[model samples]
Target chain A: MKKVTAHDVARLAEVSQSAVSRAFTPGASVAPDTRERIEKAARKLGYRPNAIARSLITRRSRIIGLVMSYLENQFYPVVIERLCQALQRDGYHVLLFISQTEDADEVLTDILQYQVDGIVMASTTLSSALASDCQNAGIPVVLFNRVAQLGAMGAYSTSSVTSQNREGGRMVGELLLRTGHRRIAWLAGAEKTSTSRDREAGLCDALAAAGLALHARGVGNYDFAEARRAVHLLFRDPASRPDALFAANDHMAIAALETLRTELGLRVPHDVSVVGFDNVPQAAWPSFDLTTVQQNIDEMVDATRNLLFDQLGGQVMARSIDVPCVLMERGTVARRDDEPGRKPGRARQPA
Target chain B: MKKVTAHDVARLAEVSQSAVSRAFTPGASVAPDTRERIEKAARKLGYRPNAIARSLITRRSRIIGLVMSYLENQFYPVVIERLCQALQRDGYHVLLFISQTEDADEVLTDILQYQVDGIVMASTTLSSALASDCQNAGIPVVLFNRVAQLGAMGAYSTSSVTSQNREGGRMVGELLLRTGHRRIAWLAGAEKTSTSRDREAGLCDALAAAGLALHARGVGNYDFAEARRAVHLLFRDPASRPDALFAANDHMAIAALETLRTELGLRVPHDVSVVGFDNVPQAAWPSFDLTTVQQNIDEMVDATRNLLFDQLGGQVMARSIDVPCVLMERGTVARRDDEPGRKPGRARQPA
Candidate 1:
């Protein structure tokens, strides 16, 4: 089979080769009827404009380097699908780089080599050196669901889109309080992540406001097995066990729920209330019926898209946008006042 | 910061520009000592090779177009992460395209326009016309976890990698039968998907061998909400309720489990048993602890990577490789003989 060329389409469409090229080039000027004719001819001859060759002249690959980790988290899969679809609609393709480690440094070299027009780091951190390198190289970078530390970025900062983590955490804490859940426990994700830090801080703020402190804390590092281990450790001493457990994310919360129910044979809400951030799809399942903080995925993804395009379209300053989150009230949160036999301050039975 | 060029690197390393290019190209030969000096200079200058320009010269983009649909399913997230990591290790990058619809037709135009060296269709189907178009364009396409219809592809066939879905389904059927499940219902995914059709067929084959048939069937279209709807439909009438249910995949099975336990207030394995294919990570969660068929993901991925590379390395024949699947016995299945109060053929109480 002969390879279809621009010349063949040009000849068939009765247009110049340059005109055919212009017709295929996005945002290039060509008469509407002539462009239609060229497109018809190209389709008939099965001719596709070579994007690689075009990138050489335009210096735009139209590829966004998406650095992500922890696909196990249900939130990310939902975000990834929506983000990809949104970007694709804007005629941009995603060059996916799965960062095995927490930081994006390892994959930075490969990402830069691709000459992508922009980058979106989701659930992955970036170092000061790499952050500056991206800026110096004139590539736009956006951190999704995260924010860069002021000290980490130094003079060069990357654009970021994040939910109001601290505020969301406070909401969760307050909800637990309003439902008469004292002796609250906090479950943390990876220690280094700003998300975990902010959420914990928010919960602390809420506790401080009410003149109450965390009963206990456990670290899961945002992993399922680790979360299960943390749940065990948190519940080891039944006498001191928390009446309410708040995990940084739904993944950990789900794991905690499983351990509490299956392993310990403890009843949710009745015995202990549970809350989590990131209202992942699993949280809504009838089996779990988890109450969590809903990070507006649509609003977050849209903010990310805007941040990236703002830079790509020649906007100068790197900005950070935080979309507000909401609380999802579900069966998991039990109002202590409604329980006929149990008092708010009474000691609960051990699992 | 000024942009670093190959010439600058060559000058700094005391080598020719062509030599600098060879040092960066993946299989291009360069003296070890010279390459080391060139790399050192490139590092000093922060010069990364332009993959876009190289693609133009080599006519090999070193990019695989990964067309996937249904990221909601926990199984695909696992596959995507592993696939990306493996391909990156092999010096290939994945250009991700999310197919919004069931078919890959819409994304195919953008995929071809990118001139990716190869394509991997994961949970997406291709039409015959597009199959031949890819073949004529001299591009290799591989369907991961799926196979193509002979009639659809005409003379142009694409390679595929899949687990033994039929055998897996049969195994599930046999397991349920061994547990004394008399009325076994089958829940299906999308009706058009080969995965769903093949699994249903295999289930029927096992029932035929046992001198029985599917007591009832419902289609979920491999969606969570749809699976919930199907579960309600299957169990709506308690008199005709199946003693055992086999969902085509773990996602649907999880949904069915949630519905059965929470909505229908039925005891899993005591009143009815549930089984699913594709032992996703969620299925192993203590809350689900699903009894399902485990498609060896690592083996399947390895087969896909090998098949793709073989074709890219000049192998002509389109191969179909089916990795064997095994049954994972967790907590969901129950032995009917163990229940002293009930018989295998007794009617279940209505929800």
Candidate 2:
């Protein structure tokens, strides 16, 4: 069977071929009645306007490259689904690229070939050289959950959307301290990541304000298994076991909860109070009931979408947006002074 | 700066423009020395071959449309990441369309406009008319984790890759029976899904062979909150409570585990044993340690990749491949007679 074309649809609809093309092109000027007639004819003839051919003429693919290295962390899957839905409403599709390497250099090279109109980089990092390469190629890029130094030219000219990581970290630290926890331990994701580093810095800021230091620290590299192992070592010394533990993200925090409950035979908020960032859905599950900082994913995704479209609309600017974070006071954190069989006002505060 | 083109690369490499195109095209023929020269020229000129233009000439977009409705299940995110990486290795990119509607018709229509080389539908269903539309358009589609009937012409001529869901369900039933649990309950996913229905059918098959039937059943629609509610209703009547419960998928099963432990205060494997399908990474976490069926994702992904590429390579055929499932024995399932204060041989079997 021969393939249907716009010409056939135009002939069937008693309109010009260019009219049929304009009817199919998004944002093109076409009369409402004409477009309706053309669409009816095209539907009858099973004709689909070729996006590739139109892309060559219009210099727009209406495709966004969504680059990520992994999805083991549950947070990204939610963001991905929402981002695709949001972009779809604006007449664009997401071309997904999962980076095989730690950094996004290799995947970006492959994505550059696709001629995507824009890009959203998640769970990956871009080098200054490649960021400039994307800039030179006229592709707008929005970093999700990551930030880079502003180069002389606005740091490769890529925009970023992130939760206020350092502030969220400080919130967790203050919550832990306000409950009369003297010994607090920290669990970190990848040390190099801005999210991990900023959150840790905020926690340190809170601890410094109270004239206390972290009692212990361990790095999990943002992996479940690594978090479990780190939890083991951090709590191995019962004599010096921290009263409270704060993990960099909900994924690692969940892992710590599981390890503490099952492996160490410890009761949460009793033996140790724990906190995490990114209040993932799992944090609210009754079993975890974790106290965490909410990253406001909707706002983050919205900011990312706006940043990308603004650049695509010919604006030459680079900006960093920090969405505010709210701390979810759940059941995981407990008041140390209110221990069972003890008076409520006698817990020692850090000196 | 002027946009670098294939003409520039051809001129710099002292070769024909077609040779420069062939060097960039996967599987296109070009002399070894010519490709090297073209690569060197491309590198020097900072020229990346235009995939869109090449796609028009080759009649292949090298983009596979990956359609999914939701990523909450966790299983699908893993599949999406793996499939993207696998296709990337073969020079194919994934165009992701997250369906806002329950079915795939709308997203499928949008995908057709892109003229993608193929498609992979996950976590969504397709109607017969739309399936045939894809078949008629010569775009091969593979349904992941779902199966459909063989229509008069092989069920719209789309391929499917799935686990042995029915057999896996039967295995769960047999294990429960062997351990002396007569009162078995079932918590289902969406009743309309083949994965859910077939699994339940298989469980009934095992029960029928043993001259028994399910003690009770509940539908969670494969959602976390719904599963928690289903667990509440299923366990409301203490005197008639089931001894074993099987959930159609791990997401719901994890929710059930959390509800039973926290909300119901029921001990897993001690008061009531539990089993789940799909053995997602969360199933192995120490807090869960769920006994479930393992759907070998690697094998399923490999099969899907092969089936899709086969059709792309001009093989006209409809095929359904079922990767086998394995029972992952863990801490969730318990032998009835082995309960505390109960003699090992005292528990009665169905007979």
Candidate 3:
């Protein structure tokens, strides 16, 4: 079968080939009636304007390179789905690159080969060298849920979107302190990550303001197994067992809850109050009923999308967006008299 | 700065442009010392071969359209990550399309415009018309973890890779029956899915061979909320409350377990035994300890990769490959004397 081209559609629709092309090109100027006629003819003839040919002419693939890691984390999959949907609405498709921290440079090289219009780096850090490469290539990159830690050089040249991690941590700290928790411990995610560091800093600040210090701490590497080990070690010394524990993320928090209850035989909010960040779907399970800081994913996604577009439109000077987090009070945290009347736990809602 | 080209690299390395291209291309012949020179020069110049231009020359985008839904299902995220990694190793990039069931056609149309070398439809159904369109377009498509249920015409023209869902379900039925659970209920995933249908059929076949029938059944639509509701309705009447519940997938099974234990105040395996398919990470969590069928994801992924390549290499005549499932004996199911001495549950292991 001979491939149907824009010429065939134009002839059938009684329009110019350029008219058919404009009709197919998103955001292109075309009369409404002409677009309708061209679309009808193209559909009838099974004509799909070759995106590759158009991309060569315009130097715009309308494809975004999404470099992501930690798919095991429930939160990331949600972020990925939302980003794809949001980007698709703007006529952009995602060229997904699953890369590890050490391999970011290699993956970035591969993405550069494809000449994706923009890049979204989620939950992973990029080296300053690669960031400079992206800048040189004129590919707008927005870090999602992670902040670049490149030393002052060209740092502000890359945009980022993240939840206010330190504030969320402070909220958890204050809640724990108000609930009469004298000894509080923290289970940090990967120590190198800015998200983990900022949240810990906020927790420390809150603790300092209350004239107390963190009783203990452990690094979970933002994983379940590591968190489980942290829980075991944290509770081994019953004399210094933390009255309240906060995990850097929900995955670790859920794992901690299970270990505390099943293995350690501790009652949540009674023997040990627990809180987590990123109110992932599993956090709301009735069995867990975890109190967590919600990261406002939709807002963060929107900010990232807008940042990429702005950068693509030649807006220089890197921007960092901080979306607010909400503390979801659930069964995991104990209630205090000084505290305001807590809303009913949102456990019953599906994630 | 001017963009570096193959000609520049050749000039710097003192080699032919074809030799420079061969050095960059995977599985291409290149003299060892000359290839090293070309790579060093390319690195020095910060040059990347333009894949878009090469794609035009080769008429192969080297991009596979991965149309998927349900990233929320933990299984899919793992699948997506593994597939991306596997495809990357084979010199292909993923153009991810997140689509809803109703919009498969629109997504397919967009995919066709990009002219991806092949398509991998994961856990989502496509209309026969779209399958025919793909075949007509000469784009080889492999349905991953799903079977095309296109009516008689052109049904056998598409390839599929799936776990033996019916066999997996039959294993569950036999295990439950052996453990003396007479009053069993089945919680199904989305009704239109071939996986759910095949599993249900196998369960029925096993029950029929035992001179029994399904005691009760409910549709969970392969979602948490829907499964929670199914659990409530199935247990509403204490007299007919099912002693054994088999969920089509791990997500629904986990939801059912939470509802049964927390809301219904039921003891798993004592009051009710639970069995689920797709032994997902959560199934092994200390709290759930769900006995389920384990789909060999690695095997399935490998088969899918091979199938797509074979199809692309002009191997016509559609084929369907079924990888086997293993029944993981965990804590959720009651033990039977006829069964071998099972090892202690591997719950402490990380998901």
DockQ of every predicted complex: 0.72, 0.72, 0.60
TM-score of chain B of 3: 0.89
- Tell me, by TM-score, which candidate is best: 1
Regions of candidate 3 where Cα sits further than 4 Å from its true position: A1-3, A7-41, A152-157, A335-351, B1-3, B7-23, B26-41, B152-156, B335-351
Cα displacement (angstroms), candidate 1, residue B291, comes to 0.7
DockQ-based CAPRI category assigned to the predicted complex of candidate 1:
medium
Whole-model Cα lDDT of every candidate shown, in order:
0.88, 0.88, 0.87
Give per-residue CA lDDT, model 1, range A125-233, as digits (tens).
Answer: 7887888898888888899988886654277777898899999999988888887877899999999888999999999888878777787999999998999999999
**Cα shift from native, residue A263, model 3 (Å):** 2.0
Task: For model 2, state the Cα shift of residue B267 in Å.
Answer: 1.7
lDDT of 3 by residue, B1-351 (tens): 256789999999999999999998889999899999999999999999988889878888999999998787889998999999999999999999998772377788899889899999998767887888887777888888888886667454578999999999999999887776667799999988888999999887787777778889999999999999999999999877777899999999999999988889998877888888888888888888999999998998899899888878774767899999999999998754343432223111222
Range of the 10 consecutive residues with the lowest summed lDDT in candidate 3 chain B? B342-351
Q: Is the docking of candidate 2 incorrect, acceptable, medium or high quality?
A: medium
Of candidates 3 and 1, the better by TM-score: 1
- On a 0 to 1 DockQ scale, where is model 3? 0.60
